[model samples]
Target: MKHLILCCLLLCACVAAHAHKPSDSYLNLVVEGQSVTGQWDIALRDLDFAIGLDANGDAAITWGEVRARQSEIDAYAMARLQLQAGGKSCPAAVTEHLIDDHTDGAYVVLRFRALCADTVSELQARYALFFDIDPQHKGLLQLMYQGQSSTAIFSPDKATQQFKLTQPSRIRQFVDYGREGVWHIWIGFDHILFLLALLLPAVVVRREQTWQAVDAFKPALWSVLKIVTAFTLAHSITLTLATLGVISLPSRWVESTIAASVVVAALNNIYPLFRERRWVMAFLFGLIHGFGFASVLTDLGLPKSALVLALVGFNLGVETGQMAIVAVFLPLAFYLRRTTLYRRAILLGGSILIAILAAGWLVERVFDMKFLPF
Candidate 1:
C-alpha cells in the first residue's frame, strides 16, 4: 500500500514536470561535393532562457529584440555545433538569420555554409545546444546527400554522430525511429493518462449503481485487450496517413483535440458512460491521438528509400511501449480491485485529477496561452 502511494506521487510529479512539450531544435544539412549548407531552427524561448533574447523584462519577445541580439545568438549557437568532413574540420559561417514559427512557438532560424577541405564522403557533427541547462533537449537532424535523405536525433548522451554520405543505413534509420517512438510514448503524459482512464474500470463492473470487483482476472484482461487493440488499430491508421502526407491537420487543432480526448476519457470514468463499451471510446479518440504522434515523424522527415521500414519500426515500438504500460498496470490494479483505497482513491480520485489536468491542457492549447506553471 505504501509503495503504491509512493508510485502515485511520483507519477504526479512527472506529469507536472512534462506538462508542456520538451525542447527540440530542427537542423537540416545538404551535402554536395565539398560544400555543406544547412539551416538550424532553435526555439526563441530556449534562446531567451539561455541568452536573454528579450531586451526588456516585459515577458514578450519581439523581432526588434531578436535582431538586436542576432550576433550573440549566432555566436551562442555556432559555438555549440561543429562540423567535420573526411577527418578535416569544415569551418562554417552564418549566411542569414531569420525567424520562423513552429507548432510549439517562435524560433530563430540560422542558415550557414561550410566548405570542406576535400570531397565529402562522410560527415561528422557534434551538437550540444541547451544540453548544459536542459538535459532533455534534442536536436533533430535531416541530412540530404546525392538525392538521398537520412535523419538522426542528437541527445545529451549521444551528442556527436557520424553519417555516411555515400549511402544511409536502413537498419540504423529503423532503430533510431523505433527508439524515438518508444521514448515519445513513455514521455507522452496525456496519452498515458488517457490509457489509464480507460483501464481504471477494467477490473470492476458497475452493478445497481455501484462498482463491484470482478471475481477473476481473465475478464479484466480481456477487457484491456479489447481497448488496447481498438486504440492501436485506430491510431496506426491515422499515424500512417498523416505521416505519408495523405492527410494533414493543423497542429493546434490536433493538440487541442487530443487534450479534449483525455478530458472526455477521464470524465467518463468518473461519470460511467460507455462502461461496457469503452473500446468504442478508445477507437474514436485514438484517431485524434494518431495525428499527435504523426507530428513527431513529420518533423523527423522520413527517408524515402526506407520509409516503410522506419514506419513499421516506430509503430512496433509504440505497441511495445504501450504493452509494457499495461503489463505494469493490470496486475497491480487487479491485485487491489476489491480494496477501498483502489476503488475510492485510485479510480475515482485519480480520474478526477486526470480530468482536471487535461482540462487545463485543453484550455491552454485552445486559447494559445499558458496558465499552468509547466
Candidate 2:
C-alpha cells in the first residue's frame, strides 16, 4: 500500500510537471543561392526565462523593454544557431525583430539574413537553443530550397542536421513526422489522462453496483481492444480532416474542450457513468482529441510532396505510442485489479486527482489565466 501511494504521487508529479504545452520554437529558413533568409518565432515566456526581459519587474513586458534589449536578444539567440553553405560558414545577422501571437502565447520573432561564400547546394544547421536549460525544448524547422520544402525537428540529442537543396526524401519525411507524432502524444498530458481515465476500469467488471476483477484476461483484453480501436478510428477521421483544412475550430475552444473531456472522463471513473460502453465515450472525445493532435502537424506544415505519406506515418506513429502505453499499463492493472490498492487508491483516488487537475486546466484555459505554474 505504501509503495502504491508513492507511485501514485510520482505519477501525479510527472503529470503536473508537463501539464502545459512543451516549449517549442518555430524556425523557417529559406535557401536561395548564396543567401539565406528566415524567421525564428520563440515564446516570450521562454525568452524571458533565458534572459531577464521584464525591465520594471511588474510582470508585463512592453515593447520598450523588448526594443531596448534587442541587441542582447540577438546576441543570445545567434550564439546558439550556426549555419553553413557549401562547406563554408554562412554568417547570419538579425534584420528585423518583431512580436507575434501563437495559440499558446506571445512570441518574439527574429527575422534574419545570412550570406555564404558560394552558392548553397546544401545547407547545414546547428541548433542549440534552450537545450541547455530545458532538454525537452524542440526547434521545429521548415527549410525551403529551390521552391521545395523540407522539415526537420531539432532536439537536444539531434541538434545538427543537413539538408539537400534538391528534393526532399519521402522516406525521411515520413520517419521524421512519425517520430514527432510519438513525441507529441507522449508530451500531451490531457490526451494521456483522458485515455488513462477510460482504461482504468478495463481490467474490472461492474456488477451489483460493485467492481469485480475479471475472471479471465480475455475479457480485459477485449475491452481494451474495443476502447482503443474506437478511439483510433474516431481520432483518425478528425485528424485527417483537420490537417487537410476540411474542418477547423478555434484553438481556445478546442483546447478548453479537451481539458473538459479529461475532467469528465476522470469523473466518470469515480461516479460510474458509461460503465460497459466506455468505448463510445472514447470515440466521442477522441474526435476532439484528434483536432488537438492536428494542431501540431498543422504548425509543422506538411511537406507538399509527401502529404499523404506523412499523414499516414504520423497517424500510425500515434497508434504505436498509444498502444505502448497500454502495453505497460493493462497487464499491471489486471494483475492488481483485485487489490484494494488498485480499486480504491488507483481507480478512485487517482481519478479524483486527475479530475481536480483537469478542472484547474479547464479554468486556466477558458479564462486565459495561469493559476498553475505548468
Candidate 3:
C-alpha cells in the first residue's frame, strides 16, 4: 500500500508539474445585423507548440518568424472555428494579425469578420482550436450582442456553444463565471498541491523530529479550520482586489512565487520550521495564489455593471470547490494519521517529493522553460 501510494504521488507530481499554468486562449466576438466581427487572442507559447512559431529553433520567437508564418497561422486558426447564423454558415475571414500581451504571456491576435446571408438573432460557434495537440487547452469566449456581453468556456468535452444576440442575462453571466471559477480551481494542480502540503500535517502533532496523530478529533478539526480559514481569507482578499483592478502583479512573478511557496510549505513539513503554525504559510502564499486565480477573470474582462455580483459568484464557487476538496481530504487524512504509512511514508517521504516537484515548477516558471515531457 505504501509503494502504491508513493507511485500515485510521483504520478500526481509529474502531472501537476505539467499543469503549472493551465492552457487557455481568449476570443472576443461582436454581432451586428448580418455580420460578426471579433478578435481571438491565443498564447504564443501554445501557437508555437502547435505550429512551430520559432523557425530557427533558437528558443526565442521573433516577429520575423511569426510574420513569415502569418498565412499558416490564419489557415490553422480560422479552419478550427466556424460561425453560423439562422442555421446557415457564415464563412469567416481573417482581416488582421497582431501581437498582444496578457497576464500569462504574449498572445497572437487575429481580427476577423464573418458575414451571413440574413439578419442574425441567434449565433452558434464551433471551436476546435488546439484540441488535437493539447487536449487540456480551453477557449475562453466573450460575445457582445445588442450592447450586452456573455462569456463561455470551450473545451474538448464542450466545443460548441450558441449565443442569443439580445440583452445579456446577469444571472447567466454569474452562473457561467461561477462555473469557470470552480473549473479553474479543480484543474489548478499547483494550487491544490500547495493546499495539500499545508493540510498533510493538520491531523498530526509534530514532536522531536517526528509526527504523531492527535488523540482527539476536536484539535485536528480546529487545526484544519485555522489553516483553511486563513488560506480562504487571504486568497479571497487578493482575488477581489486583483479582479477589481485595484492592484496587479506580473504573471511570471506571481506564478514563480506561488511555486516557491509550495516548495517552502512542503519542505517545512520535513524540516518543521513553522511546526504547528502552518496557517501562516497558507495566508502568505495564498495571496500569490489569488493572483494566479485572477488571470482567468482578468483575461475574460469583468462586466462593468455586474462587477460585484460576478466577483461574489466566482469567489463563492472557489470556496465551494475548495471545501469539497477538504471534505474528501480531511476524512482520509484523519483516518491515515495513526498509521506508520502516514507518519513516515506520507508526511516525511511525500513532503520531500512534493518539495522536489515544486522546486522543478519554480525553475520552470521563473526561467520560462519546459523541462518536463508533458
Candidate 4:
C-alpha cells in the first residue's frame, strides 16, 4: 500500500510539472469615432508552429526571415481576429509590423487600423489565435474607449466578447483579476510543492538527525507563522517591483531558479541544513517566486488607473488561496504527526518525488525543451 501510494503521488507530480508554460498574446485596441487602431503581439514560437518562421532550419529566427513573411503573418493573425462595430464586420488593414521582447520570449507586433461603417458604441472582438494549435493559448485584451481602459482575457470558451464604449468599472476589473490570481496559484504546482516541503517539517522537531512529533501545537504554529510571513513579505516586494517595471530578470533564469528552489527545499527535508531556520529558506526562495507571479500580471498590461487596485486584489487572492492550502494541510499534518505515514510516506517519500519532479522542471526550463506532456 505504501509503495502504491508513493507511485501515485510521483505520477501526479510529474504531470503537474508540465502543466505550466508560456502561452499568451497581447491585444491593445483604441476606438476613435468610426475607426479602431490597435497593436497585436503574438508569440513567434506559436507562429513558427503555425507557419514556419525559421527559414534555413538553423533553429534561429531572424528579422530578415520574419520581415520576409510579413504578408503571411498579417493575413494569418487578422483572419483569426474579427473586429465588429455596430453589428458590422470591420476588416483590419495591416499598417506596420515589428518584433518586440516580452517576458516570455520574442513576439511579432502587428499594428493595424479598422474602419467601421457606422458609429462605434458596442465594440465586439472575436479572437481565435492559436486555438487550434495550442488550446492553452490566451489572448489578453486592453481596450481603450471614450478615454477609459478595460481589460479582458480571451480563451476558447470566452473567445467572442463585446465591450461598451464607456468608462470602465473598477469593481469588475478587481474581481476579474482577483479570480485570475487565485486560479494561478492553484495551477502553480511548483510553488505549491515548495511550500509543502517547507511545511512538512513544521509539525515535527529534529532530534539526533531524526524527525519527531511535537507535543504542543504552539511551537509548530509559531514556526508556520514565521515561515509563511517571511515568504509572503519577500514575494510581495518582488512581485510589486517587477510588475511596476522597477526590476526585471530573464524568464529563463527566473523559471530555472524557481525549480531549483523547490529541489533545494525538498532536499533539505531529508538532509538537515539550517535546521529550524526554514523561514530563511522560504524568504530567499519566495523572492524568485515573485517573478513567476509577475509574468501573468504584467502580460495583462493593466492601465495606470486600475494598476494599484488590480495588484492589491490579485495579491490578496493569492494569499487567500495559500491560506486555503495551509488550512487543509496543517490540520491533517498535525493530526498525523505521530504516525509513520506522516514521517516515512508523506515526508520522506513525498519529498523525494517532489525533488525528482523539480529537477525535471529545471532541465526543461534551462534547455527550453518540452520533456513532459501536461
Worst 10 residues of 2 by lDDT: 9-18
Q: lDDT score, residue 181, model 2?
A: 88
Candidate 2 Cα errors over 4 Å, as ranges? 1-17
Instruction: Rank by TM-score, highest first.
Output: 2, 1, 3, 4
Estimate every model's Cα lDDT from 0 to 1. Answer: 0.88, 0.88, 0.84, 0.85
TM-score for every candidate vs. truth?
Answer: 0.95, 0.95, 0.93, 0.84
- Ranked candidates (lDDT, high to low): 1, 2, 4, 3
> lDDT tens string, model 2, 26-106?
999998878999999998889899998998888778888889999999999999999998788999999999999887888
* Location of the lowest summed lDDT over 10 successive residues in candidate 1: 9-18
Preferred candidate (TM-score higher): 1 or 4: 1
Question: Which residue pairs of candidate 1 clash?
Answer: none
Mind giving the per-residue lDDT tens digits that candidate 1 earns over 1-374? 67577447424623553553568899999999899999999999899999998788887899999999999999999999999987899999999999998877899999999999998988999999999999988999999998999999999999999988877888888998998888778778888888988998999999988778999999999999999999999999999999898999999999999889988988887788898899999999999989988887777778899989889888888888899889888888888888887788788888888888899899999998876866
Which window of 10 residues has the lowest lDDT sum in candidate 4? 6-15
The residue-by-residue lDDT of candidate 3 on 239-331, one tens digit each, is 989998899998899999998998999889888888788998899888988898887778766777778878888888888888887887777
lDDT for 356 (candidate 3)? 83
Per-residue CA lDDT of candidate 4, range 1-374, in tens? Answer: 65545434433533455535457899999999999999999989789989999999886789999999999999899999999988899988999888998876789999999999988998999999999988867888999887788998888888999888888889888987886677677678888888888988998999988999999888989999988998899899999999999999988899999999999999999998968999999999999999999987888887788899999878887888888777777776787788787788788888898898888888988998766654
Number of the top TM-score candidate: 2
Better of 2 and 4 by lDDT: 2
